[model samples]
Structure formats: structure tokens, C-alpha cells
Target: YYAEMTLVPVLNYLDIVGTVKRHLLGPRARNQVDMDFYFKGSAFYLADLYTGMSKVVFLCFWYASIIPAVYFLTAATLMVHYISYKFAILRSYRAGPKLGAELAIFGRVYIFPLAVFFLFMQADYNWSSFPFDNVCETNSTKVTDSYIGSHNLQYEYRDKDGGETNFLDNIKYPVEISEGDSYFKFCNQDMYNHSPKVFPAFPFFQDDESKWMSDDQAVFSWVFSILVIVVLTLVVNSILVRRLGASILSYFKASYKPQAITINQRFSEQSEISAYVPMKCDPSFLFPLLLCDISDIDTELIGWEDARNKYDSHNLSTDVIDEMKEDNEDAKCYCILKHFPPKKND
Candidate 1:
């Protein structure tokens, strides 16, 4: 919406004006000085200025968009980890290993596709013919005459209206003459034989053919640059995510052991230790205990003594049963049948 409202209009205006100037007025306008020079110069100057300004604007847009995009992606990733730690630690803990392996495999697989997408977006695929060289010719003519007569006096030729005529038309020279006579000496003989000739040497000439031939190279360069940028961004982003995930996982692992230890200590002191001395049992073992009225246990024929014998006879600790009894002797003891220790052989 922002682009449509602000940027697109400006870009369209620039495109329209640029197309008109480049295609319509650029070729037809002659390089002649006149009262219109100021207007023409101002127009061209404004166009050049706008072209440079547009480039800066485009660059700013790219920078603005890319920086925020990268930052948002990074921030969102961190936020996800934070939320995982806060309310979803169990899932987060399990997800770390699986996500890490997937990222490693997918990062390698998608690198080339990312590069190609970038290249296609930035590349110009239009094909047109260009000129290599051009030749232009202009022609003019001059007339001269050959004469064998000797002139007594040199006189300037004039037209009937007394206008000066070119004297070279009246001049004459012998095609073949024997040398050694002063009277037949050459007088301005070399001047009549010379014709004005112009030979221009122009280097670095290119026409439509050259432009057409080079267009593909230009397009290839643009595509290649875009590909390079995309590949770099992808690889860098993948590395960053991989590192971030590892860091989060490490922090979770580092915090887990301490928390587990604290829970173990609390449970042990409250229920496992018969007295101050630690019992000969696995500190890590988990158990379930049941609570009921003493009447219910006697009615079911599963008395406290029976339950204790059922679990403790197999060498498993019945801490819950003892803890419940200590808390209330008259309170009945119910067994967590699912967690009951296996029967012992007599």
C-alpha cells in the first residue's frame, strides 16, 4: 500500500518522462544554438539530475527494505526461542536436535535454487540486434581546364556582372612538355592539378550491431551479480540461524541439569530419606503413591502392611507409603497399582 501510494507514482512519472525524452526528443533535436537553448539545456539538465536522484532513491529503498527484513527475521527467531523457554520448554528441548539436522540438510539443498531465483529477478532477458559500424558519405564537385597557350599578363577573371569568378577554371597546363625553356616555364602549374581531398579517420565506431551483440553480456553480468548477492545472503542467514539454534540449545542444556538436581533434592528429603542417612536406592527412580481412608484399605484386603510387602519385598523403595503413614497413621494407604514393584520369589 505504501509503495502504491508513494513510490509507484514517482517511478511511473520518471519512466514516462524518461521514455519520452529518450525516444522522441532525443534523436530529432538538432545541436543548434537559438533562443530555445536555455529551455533545451534546462530540460536535459533536469533529466540528468533526476536520473541520478532516482538511483539514490532506489538504493535507499533496497537498503531500507533489506535491513529491516533481515533484522525482523533474526528478531522473530530469537523471540520464538524465548517463548519456547518460557512456556514450551519440553517441546523446545526436543525440537532442537531435529531442527538442527533438518536445517543442515536443507540449507545445502536450496542454495542453488536461491541463487537462480535471484539471478532471474535481476537479469534482463530481452534480445535485440546492435550495429558494429556505420559509414556515411557526402559529395561535392570542382571543375578545372587544361591550356597550352602562354599568357602575356596575369589577369583576374570576372563574370558579366563584374563579380569575381574563380580563376582556376581559366588556367591551363601542358600534359607533356620538354623541360629547358624559360618562356614555357611553369607558372602556377602545380596549383591547377591539386584537387581538395578530405580523408577522415574515425576510430571506435559502433552501430546497432555492436549494441545488440553486447546486450547479452551486460545481462549476464547483472544476473551474475544478483546471484552472488542472493547466495551470500542465504548462506549467511543459514549460518546465523544454525548458530543461534545451537546457542539456545546450549543454554537450555546448561539450565536443565541444575533444575533437575534441585527437584531431586527436594523429593529425596521429603520422602526418600527414612532419617538423616540416605537410603540405598536410585535417586533418579520415579514412583507413584496412593492415598485413601484406612477403612477402604481393610475392606479391599490391601492393607498398608500388604502394600509395603508387595513393593518393598522386591527391593524397590516404598517411600510414599511410609510418608503418608507418618503424615497420618489413621489415614488409609492406597497403592498406585501401575507403578507397583514386581513380585519377589519366595
Candidate 2:
């Protein structure tokens, strides 16, 4: 009963302390200049809007007191912290651009804290219930002692008759196990108990004591670290190269020479030949006279095939060409009649 009472106030105090620490020492906590700058920013604007709404509610008798101020301050602090954390994470990505480094930074900031919190919770639960054995046993020890020398140990096997038998005696390891007894015999029936053959209390977690990970795990870790470093170095170098390229291009553009323009006489000659010709009469008034030329040409005289081929080659309809031909004939006839009047034979 006393423990529960004590724990409640302690927990409440810890919660308050944590909140204070987050506000005062978090990434958002900065100098006066920075604080003023942030206050003028969007974050401050939102906080003010919320605070104003709260004041309006209090005036209307919906809210009690200055609790709104406290809430607004807390919300503003959390918002600033969130923004700063996001900027810091993005900055880390820009620094290296390596997947591993990005993951590591993300883990450090977000995942690691959560993991620590979970571990602390588990430890707290464990501490509340003392003298309990979990998954790992405290007394178990693996014995590797053999009667034969370490090199010759491979030849020895267990026998069915509870005697030692050797592989070189024309017997398989399994057959020897059935024929002999060479496997280690435990002194205690409890599997958790260590054999009398091995030294007690040897630290298996240490590098010096661990037989499996001392060499292989170290090599793997070293290789992984070197690879991550190389990748990060390459990413930084690539960015630098791109920036240098852009600078060089800008320099070239600034100092570039302009090419002189030269005119060609051939184009000028073609333009002169294509000059426009003026019409003799207004097109609207001479419509009927234009029709008089085609009045002499028979439309049925031209076959479809001939007309199509002729039109395709000349880029004109045969009927139009026949009309022009008739016009020329009529003009010749008129000239003959004007020059030589018809002799009257009355």
C-alpha cells in the first residue's frame, strides 16, 4: 500500500520533469533571436489563433481560466520540435545519401528511443516481480571436453555397449555410436548444470571468450563499415562533380563568342523571280468573261483516266487547262478579225 502511494507521486513528478526537459532542452530550444524569429513564423500564428479562440470561449463562460495558455504553449513547443526534427533528418540524408546512413539516423532519432522505452518498460515489469527465471537459464553450461586429443577427437564415437569405438576401425560414426561409447557423459542430470570438465563463470558475451564470433563477426562488421563509408564518399564526390560541371557551363556561357550572320545571293535571286503580276481587270466584274473561254471546250471530250494522270502531273484539273487553251484560240481569232476585215461578197 505504501509502495503504490509512493510510486504514484513519483511517476507524476517524472512525467512533469520529462515534459519540462523536452520543452527546455529539445532541438527547438534556441537563443532569444531564434525564439523571436519562430514567433513571427507560421507556428506562432497558429498558436495565437488557438489561444484567441480559447479566450473567446472563456468570455462566453465555456472555459474556466488560463488553462488555454498552458495548452497553447505546450502545443507550440511540440510543433517547433517536430519541425526541427524533420529538418535535422532531411539534413542527414543530404549529408551522405546512403541507405545505411539514412536508416541509422532514422533509427537513432526515432526507433532507438522507442526501443529503449520498451526495454525500460520490460525491465520495470521484471523488477516489480523479483526472483523470476525467464527464457535464459542461469546455470546451463555446454561442455566440449573429449578423452581423445582435439585433432584425433573426430575419430572417436559413442558405442551401443557403452564403450569407446574409433572410426578407423572400419566403422561409420553412426555405426560406431551403436558399437561404442565415446560421446561425453554429463555428471549432472540437469541440462542446465555445467560439466565438471570446463571452467565455471566464463563470460561468453566478450569477444575474447566467444569462439564463434571473435574472427568472423569482426571481419563482417569491418567490411560493412568500409562499404558504407565508400558509398557515402562516392555520393558526396558525385554532388561536387555536378556542381563543378554547372559552374563550368555557366562560365562558358558568360564568355561565349557570338557568330556573324552572312546573306546568300542564291536566295535573293529566287525571290526576284517569284515577284507578283498585276491582273488586267477586277476579278469580280470579269467573272462571265472568264467563263466565255471554257464555253467552247466540251466537258465530255476528256476521259477520267487521262484527266486524272494529266491533273496529277501538272497539279491542275484537265478542264481548267482546256479552258485556258480555248481562251488563247479565241484571242487569236479576235486579233485576225481586227487586223483584216472580212471581204464583203454581196
> Best candidate per TM-score, number?
1
Clashing pairs in 2: 158-177, 158-180, 158-182, 159-179, 159-180, 159-181, 160-178, 163-181
TM, every model: 0.17, 0.15
lDDT of 2: 0.34
Cα lDDT tens digits, model 2, 135-227, are 222232433344223332235567789887656565333322222333332222111232332211122322232122235434543443344
Sequence-dependent TM-score of model 2 = 0.15
Worst lDDT window (10 residues) for model 2?
333-342
User: What are the lDDT scores of the predictions, listed in order?
Assistant: 0.35, 0.34
Candidate 1, residue 245: the lDDT equals: 66
lDDT of 1 by residue, 1-346 (tens): 2332344334433444444545567666575222222222112222332343333334333333224453344344344433433332232111121133554344444533443433333221211111212222112122123333344433356788978765645555434322332221112111112123211101112132222234454555455445556665666566666656666788767633343333433322343222221123221322222233222222223322333234344323333345635675332334232222224541
